[model samples]
Target chain A: MHVTSSVRPPLITGGKTYADVTEDICRQVEGKPTKEWKIAFTISVIVLAYGTACLFWTWWEGLGVWGLNKTVGWAWDITNFVWWVGIGHAGTLISAILLLFRQKWRTSINRAAEAMTIFAVLCAASFILMHMGRPWLAYWALPLPNAFGSLWVNFNSPLVWDVFAISTYFSVSLVFWYIGLIPDLATIRDRAQNKVSRYIYGTLAMGWNGSAKTWARYEYISLILAGLSTPLVLSVHTIVSMDFATSVIPGWHTTIFPPYFVAGAIFSGFAMVQNLMLITRVVYRLEDYITLEHIESMNKVITLTGSIVGVAYLTEFFIAWYSGVEYESYAFINRATGPYWWAYWTMMTCNVISPQLFWSRSIRRSVTWTFFISVIVNIGMWFERFVIIVTSLHRDYLPSSWAMFSPTMYDIGDYIFSFGFFFTLFLLFSKYLPVINMAEVKSVIRSSSEKLPAKVAGVAKGERVANPTFNKDAE
Target chain B: MADLHGKYLVGVYDDDEVILHAISKIRKAGVKISEVYSPFAIHGMDEALGHSRTRIGIAAFMFGVTGCICALCLTIWTMGIDWPMIVGGKDPISIPNYIPVTFELTVLFTAFGMVGTFLVTNNLGPGVNPNMFDPRSTDNKFVMAIELGKNKLTEEQISQVLKDSGAEEVNIKQF
Candidate 1:
């Protein structure tokens, strides 16, 4: 409602009506796939198949199939885990955080972002499963009664906390996404051309009829869910950061890691969202719904959070020098000047230096530049996690144990496998589900319904005596 | 048609404002309204129709409190009473470390509980058939229905009331 003239660009560009909103969104679901979609889907499947084979090979031969040595035991595995987890943050931030703030623009993008969250979390969970050499025994991580001398899972460890956080995060996000989808699914259900499609949409819709009573309850539930997910978006990452913060490792023990990791997570998350939205907008030909203004607003968030992450980077360096602990100072120095200095410099440039370009209004608004920088920012964030995990562990207190960590073919293969998995799921989602939320987008339109002043005039002059301005029904 | 419940006169409106205006007009004439439908949520239509504010938030709060209590009890029972093991030189009954999982379960239960309450209250589930007043009610049109059996008004009076209230089309629907 607070409309700044310049910042308040019309979210839907083409003056779409309620019917147009439904048609544009439901078309992708009901219609045949384009040539572009076929090509992308094929490539994604191929990559996915190759990645799955690599993962099985690692599992078949043991963790040694990857180049992981004793010193860098968590090199690419945890880096991919954190990277995927960070990418998932953008979805909840958009759906839950922005919803509470009443940013109406989020309606256009939240659906796809929520789907991305589910897939990214799936990818993140896979890394944990793969890292456990005998994944069948991964149930030991849960707080279940084990046969090993009644040894219960440790309640004080961050790893155990992660199990609860990630699982709850997944189920809650899934429910929230499904609840939001109901009404839109009803719209699709009503418009389905065939019996099979109709039944499928009907089951998904769960008997939504758009009754006033149901809408009232639905709106209330949505607000409360958004309220619930806000703290969740923050807590999941804070627990993840605790994976390092609670440790005794020199580079990982800083108090700044919680908020710092959170900021970096959001920065990278938005970058990934931008990357996906750029491709989605093009492939789906949804420029009108996903306007340039949406891109610019997301860029503005990146500029702010990116700057916060940049400051956190500098703050870590200052604290390292200020504390003057030999091990801690050496850890920071080793990150910048040691064998893995390239990874550190990569993080600095991508996470800090590159995103600052958004300070220019022109670059932030340009689709190509935003896309390019988003990719770079994610790369930089991946290296940040890599630098923190590998460099710190590769060199410890004993100089005799000093070593360098490098990823093997299997390591590289597994990461690409995630991309394949992510895109394949995403492509399927885009084809089946309503990409844009029809109900929410309709709420944002200026016209609530069709203007029929001429029809209202047909009710006779006597009816107007009761309500004089009945003809001003343009809204 | 054999399983139809009753005869209801349905009035269609192009705009939400018109429907709001029509509801008051029809109800003021001593006609009982059965239901109203719209494509999207109108801002104050529920209040105008005299429905009470939903108590879902209260349910969410109570569920959240339950989650908090359960989480604390689970952590205590598992770590302190069941089997105590020192971790990272910290106490087995450390409450600070218990906060993360506790907070997570609190949110998780609250969210699931609230959604469950909503679904049950609405009589909705996977295979249940919905009552549809009109297909276009989920699209662009708004509809208000007055069941003849619920009100003592004659067919002529109800039709007249709908027209006087500026209904675009009035139809006799059996569902």
Candidate 2:
């Protein structure tokens, strides 16, 4: 397997030193914000301000502020919640799944993706609180004893399960992200020139000395954490899918929902990662680190998972017809030909058909094409959630009780508010932390142009120079 | 730097392979190495230094078991005993339904417990002053430090051993 070729593609394209890696990442934090960063940060802050205003209005005014009726109790709120939760999945999949599979390319992008997971989950949890109407009583979802005669949470309910799953997922992701940052934080700490910066980076670094003993344990802990996170990522999405599956709603009650949702979660998750990565690569001027090869590899994943999600769409219909359940059959038919047919076709075209273009190597390799398709795919996934929710709830078993669901100004505002929250946190994260993992990326640098270790001048003069070929093999 | 203790001899190298080679050579010569630091982890360096494997996985597994049992007991006590009100015409104590929460908590406890164990074992956390041998160790250099007071050999002998092991630069450090 040691095929030393002149054409071997380096993950880090530019010949870079460990010092360059540190400067590339730490300068973004230490230096003043660039003009592009200033513009993006301002937009995010404005969006957040407006969104917070809408949420305050919802709080002061009540549930009537939104366009929820008796028939469609969960129109946009739950849809946005599930969408944000789904977006969070790609981050963990990139970090934990790729690490487990020994995909070394993830070293360049995993830090940013994990940050995305944390922010996306935060946006998702906000919807749950807002949907509660009385947000102050949000803790009731927890399995806690109450003052009124020991009324505990209902264990059989999926909503209660959601509280545990989401809280656990959020906390675990936070710890995992923080632990991975320690070594890099130490790099920043060592490079700090000012007193305040030294104190901040030093505290975050947690006194890492980078000893051989410490490095060994750090690696062991990382592996165990990766193993732990694999199942947790799958479980988080599975439990979220259960929220719909356990219900009696015709479109919602399928055994296929778990796998189907997981696939779609990954599909959309990669799209968002691509979306953010494209902007980051350009804004941070990091084309050498996040090469077009990286983008193409991610597009390959988006295409693969996107196709799986498409197959899931068809499988749901086939099962609906094969089961001979009239309600299920009607639900499928209505989704295609009902008043919301536009949304249905949009989802199919974007998620099912559009990503098929990636099968072409030229399109997959093109940054512009990949970026355009990623955005379209994200739009399609959002519509998929909307169609599932609105199409199912809008129609009733009795025609007399049937009603159409439409979003009010408040609904639109709340959805926009989530974007504001997600972007705001993401922008801050990019500016404050190393956008790429410095320590992990340093381990992957194998450029032949790197300076070789020289032999000691006296007794070791004739000894063979150690070039790290075996080090590369062990890694 | 006021509380500086014993003098430390610091050896610097540019590559991990040289450090690994030097570690084995120096250890073979019977010089005690206090620690080796690098910008990135050099695989198998611990084994070269004869350090044993870490056991943090055991702590993780035990923490997971505790989470699973605690989750099950809570589900049973609340759904089957404390307030067993039937909803959706299902059984009060539903084992399958409780699986999600159980799994979630198990993962949660495992992750947090392992991280805490790592911090305590490594003596790492905010406000803990780090023992920095050289600032460039976090840059493009690898550093191996040997304490003069810890080893039976004199400082000059250890410095000679480091030079023979292919260290590019050897200097005396105080911290």
Candidate 3:
């Protein structure tokens, strides 16, 4: 009954079986940390320690420690916030959007990507807290009955919408992720060799027994969650874009921001996913699961979204010029020819130009080239935010108040802090949890695995021979 | 963990296809199946086992409606009725601005509510131990359990039917 196109290359290689899938994925969770993992973990912890200290001082010394002036009140903090939030989008896109589209290749990478999403969103939220100078009064952003008066939060404000959007996104994604993890957790629980691991994984598994009734419900809920999440993901970035779009600033106010920002978010998010997954694939020896075909497929997405982002940039400039508003025209011209031209050009080259290289099949399939481009894409994305936020604000209508913004050490340190925090959380997750979704992978192995030879494939022809490897010694 | 106190015949299957076929053959032989468990969800196995489609979708839709109504009530009550201050000179009750929050709350409620209902219905929660017929059911095996008392066939007859229908191993489970 499980039919697949013979022309399509195998998603899972090495002719693996059900037992092998469990063994291969579970070994990483059950085994001791490899030397490479120890080294990587130690480095992450060191970076986190330094970042925490810098973050502490930033909180202690206050906003003056950053390079924020009246002209550029929102520099590195908002840029980092947007950047991290954009990175979080890829996880939801892969898990929810791809699920709806029936993209089977997503099974190999969705677990780790969703984890990345959660951690990235956490990092993004940290920036919002950090930007609020008086972090203690953060709860005032919420709609609460105030003691001062009967006043409530302004429901019309985009910032309040952000508060709702981000919190809802975080909580819903967490639930979706945990729901997906239950069956795989049960697998780990059943295979645990020690009492501690057994007890721990047991509680986390929530007593999943893989009954037909439970699986039926599980699939149903997963589909509904995916349906809910598609629009949720789009709305998150749309609301983020509205934060600037609703403003009256020359460059900030644009009708195209919602779609443009969403495209750019997915573009940057995929780049981040590629970076993390490539490193993870190598470190965990997961080449069989995260195959080259998977890498190539991701590259194709990168090219498509990157092209869309590129088109948006061109359209923004075209609309700015065609609208004939002197302020908006000046903003676009200044972005290309102003004091911040270096940042603008960097954004163009990195975001608009670099991902186009993925058009070549050889380069798309090359691990070295992909990793190098992914890093470049991330740098470009960060610069894109900087150009949009800083350039638009630096030269206000009044020439007397115009000033250039430059980051102090504290600004740089805070950005580093998010990086440190993200990696540290990611490393811990990789070490402790099953990076690959075991049960989901087992299900797909029947239709997408490498075909077995006739000698090893004991089943009759025309019946589904799901990568049968009856001769275990052949491996 | 609920103590299982029944005698049952458990047939272990190595492949999902074999188990799926076995469900119909064993049912045709007049033996009622108690449950079938597997490492992964076997497509069509639910229908083969004669289970009707789940109603979780209806529950999710209801939760979503509740969320939409709640969001509308919160916005209308706070922004329109309660001491409304006109900041940008727009109307005190702005439905356009309300769309984002309304949409967000709807999704939030639907996701959490449906998941909560799923957990409660499936009898799943943290620290709740499940009655696993075979531990390997979470690994690679497909296990079919039948309460011996409920079935009309003898143990030997049922075991023969299971073997003929492609069960690799047959065992007695006392819960």
What local lDDT score does residue A265 receive in model 2, on the 0 to 100 scale? 88
Going through the candidates in order, their DockQ values are 0.60, 0.62, 0.59
Q: Write the per-residue lDDT of candidate 3 for residues A259-347, one digit (tens) a residue.
A: 98998899889899999999998888899999999999998998898999899999999999999998999999999999999999999
Query: What proportion of the real contacts between chains A and B does each prediction keep?
Result: 0.74, 0.81, 0.83
Error of 1 at A264 (Å): 1.3
Chain B TM-score of all predictions, in order? 0.92, 0.92, 0.95
Residue A141, candidate 3: how far off, in angstroms? 1.1
Which interface RMSD values do the candidates have, in the order shown?
3.3, 3.1, 4.6
Pick by lDDT: which candidate is best? 3
lDDT of each structure? 0.85, 0.85, 0.89
TM-score of chain B of 1: 0.92
lDDT of 1: 0.85
Model 2 ranges off by over 4 Å:
A1-8, A148-150, A447-475, B1-5
> For model 3, what is the alpha-carbon lDDT of residue B147?
88
Clashing pairs in 1: none
